[model samples]
Target: MMLCNESRKEAAGLTPFLTPRKTIRLATWNIRTMYEAGRTAQVAKEMKHYNTCLLGLSETRWLQTGQLRLTTGETLFTKKSKIKLNIIQCYAPTNDTDDEKKDAFYQQLPAVLDKAGKKYMAILMGDFNAKIGADNTGYNEVMGTQGLGYINENGERFADLCSLNQLVIGGSIFPHKRIHKATWRSPDHVTENQIDHICISKKFRRAWKDVKVMRGTDISSDHHLLMTAVRLHLKKFKNTTNMRTRYNVSVLKTKEVRTAFHLSLSNRFQPLQDQIENNDTNIETQWKLEARKEKKVVLNTSRTRAAKAKAQEDYTATDKEVKKNIRKDKRDHINNLAKQAEEAAGQGNLR
Candidate 1:
């Protein structure tokens, strides 16, 4: 939380590069509790300015109940190769009552992947907060020989669910690289580690190469944001991928499902104005006609609603881009300082 009277600067860092095959690259970070207003502004700057196609942000500390809002707001998700494809940011409760929280996480997670359709290839990465179960990754502690290692107990379960569902764990951390382990560096230094994990599905693996982590840049926060990049497998025919698969029209798709209701309303009301004008003996039926008009009015209102929604998204993107450029300028300034210091060190030695 930041004070209303306080001043803060955005400070988000990211490394960007073009892939060999022209696929887009994406990265993930937990970013601690995003309730820190100052940091969230920075996260938006890095996420957007880097042109990240996918960002799995967790511990956003943003309660759906409106405890906070991302600098980019709820509608950052848009169409057009999903110019903005951000997923749910979660902070699964770690208390004693977290037993079935994994169930809740899975319940929510699959829907996103499903809505993402078959070919979009999501870059799902975040602070899973999952501890490796019992003596596996160099730590040797057991809860009862059964190895009930838990932190993201349910969060870990969800990560496994992602794997079982065919997602791939990317980076030096996980079943793939499985080296240079130990990401969660606790002050008390408990060996139970690797809570911050980066994962993606098989549909997105071949795109991820040379995945690595940022060793040390001690700012603050209990967990270091796991850093990894993936060159999104850009298909040759990418246009008709996510937006229009025949499978999209199903028992699911609540958003598109509303179209049926909308069309019905439109059919009933739009011609009513002419119907009333053409009929002379229908005055007694005014209530019925007005009811039909109401339905059409409601449906027609959606046209304006969609326009505003798109406009808002455009505005948020513009603001985010401006702020990100400013942060990049600041980072360049710091890099210049380090170079000057190194040059001075070299000159002093020459003397």
Candidate 2:
């Protein structure tokens, strides 16, 4: 019920949590196949803890399963937004051929790009099951000019896509030279290939800061997790850029951004006519003072309930069959911290 109510608010684009990033924080993770068990729950837990703005997951296996809804709903600020999850998971044709299967994958690339680009900047992140322009995949300087080669990227497919879409490739090439490089398969597993990948569009290239592949984590799966962070270069209008300018004590008297608070409060309370209304203030005043404290408690309760629920539910699960969701009890703890941080920083722009 709470999720539904909150979702309604979100659908209205009334997300009160998105603090216009002083900078953008984006991350991509190839959370092992969610359906396999606890993996989904663990990934959710991590994401909520980070409160990440932009998140991408790959090898999601979302095409066959409906697990994508859970991911898109909770991550996106609004409920109405389409599930913009960017992960490609499929069975590659195993003629022991990368080119044929890759061609099919590439054929679908345009549609994938179109679908994701409709919203905020899109990232074509997932397992391509293909290698890039490396390891002399048939000598060719023209391919490099055409953006189709890497030192160890055996084939031209990886290069072609990166060049075509201007997507920044996020991953490492060290394993490509070795006999085996695989995210979905390990020595313990049957297959081996570095198929998993994460890529971002040109628009989001500014946020392309850091990309790290988490090689060892007890994820119950043999595949290494890809943890990539992209810092979006958020631009803010400088009120004053001069550092030598004299500090004004009067500036503290100035107001900060007041869009949400003003609209919600004044729109509701301003029409309350007489300062001392018809009901008589003597009785109402006493109760108002008494209730103020309680009202605060309720608001605090709600905030804590929301944030803690997010954190606990995100990380508690140890099985893939069932999501170890955050507990409702811990929400207050998180909300209190958020409130404390807001007060300490004096940045109360919550909307």
Candidate 3:
């Protein structure tokens, strides 16, 4: 019931320490059943021998779904990340299973795919109990012409599911001998079929370099080990030095700091007063100038006391307005930075 990853030391867990751009071998096998004594150890030994980074298992026959760590240092049921590789391990109902159950299985699968999202490279693989044969007539987009046997009822359903999700059947795409293509052999060892499969999302179809049945592997099971070579490169880390600085604007809430900040602004304005009196500038520049030039012009040209007094009043109002605008701009900038920081945190980019 639980999908597992079997690997060597350092590679024993799932995606925690996977090297970027490295070729990882992923596989799926219906070990028929994993109830026998030391069956897990036997599978892990063959997995290490094949250098498989992650292996999806079917028919584990475990009573519950949860993490299980073996004494051999192998962990089961973990996740992957970044330009993430989402692997869904399945052990579908057989062809004889009721139609309602098969329909439910196919319906629930899309929900899982939706949870994974379209942005990731998803690999859906396992013992599907379906046989999509060599004829890629109607299901040309999702399969190839190199499959093992003729299409069955389960095959039609499987092919339709792959086409709906835009998944490419990896086992059917490459030219391999019938022995390499077949994933399951009958108990009598007389009949063989490629029921087990590994499928990759069509968008990342190129990442799947190759897929074939590893018949040499021995696990005392009827199913052969179906392995795929996948090239995965996680997105590189961004440089922290180039990130924007988050200023401490909380100090502005203190009266002393506000007064000091205003005092500093007033002192800085003293030097620009003369320049403003001599030049015509933009709106922002005029605001910074505090209408000093307009005041000076009125004083020099107007002879009436009433006109001079009115001009003086206008200049005082303009100065207050400029200070108010400056305060508003500062508050807006701080709020914008806080919003950005919240968004970054949500995206798991605290830096």
Tell me, by TM-score, which candidate is best: 3
TM-scores, all models, native as reference: 0.44, 0.44, 0.61
Q: Which run of 10 residues does model 3 get worst, by summed lDDT?
A: 1-10
Please write out the lDDT profile of model 3 over residues 1-351, one tens digit for every residue.
Answer: 122444433333335423445777889988877789888889878878888877898888777654567776566643332213478889899999999999999999888887878787888999999999999998899999999889998999999999999999998899998999999999999999999999998988877779988999998899999999988555569877866789899999999999999988885675367446734333574556656667667767877999888887877777777777667666765676689679879999654
Index of the highest-lDDT prediction: 3
222-286, model 1: which lDDT tens digit per residue? Answer: 65545555555565765655664465546446867678868777855754665466553233345
| lDDT by residue for model 2 (255-347), tens | 553455467777466435433353322443445445555544444555567765654443332221121122322454456557756875786
Any idea what lDDT model 2 has? 0.47
All candidates: CA RMSD (Å): 35.6, 29.2, 18.0
Better of 1 and 3 by TM-score: 3
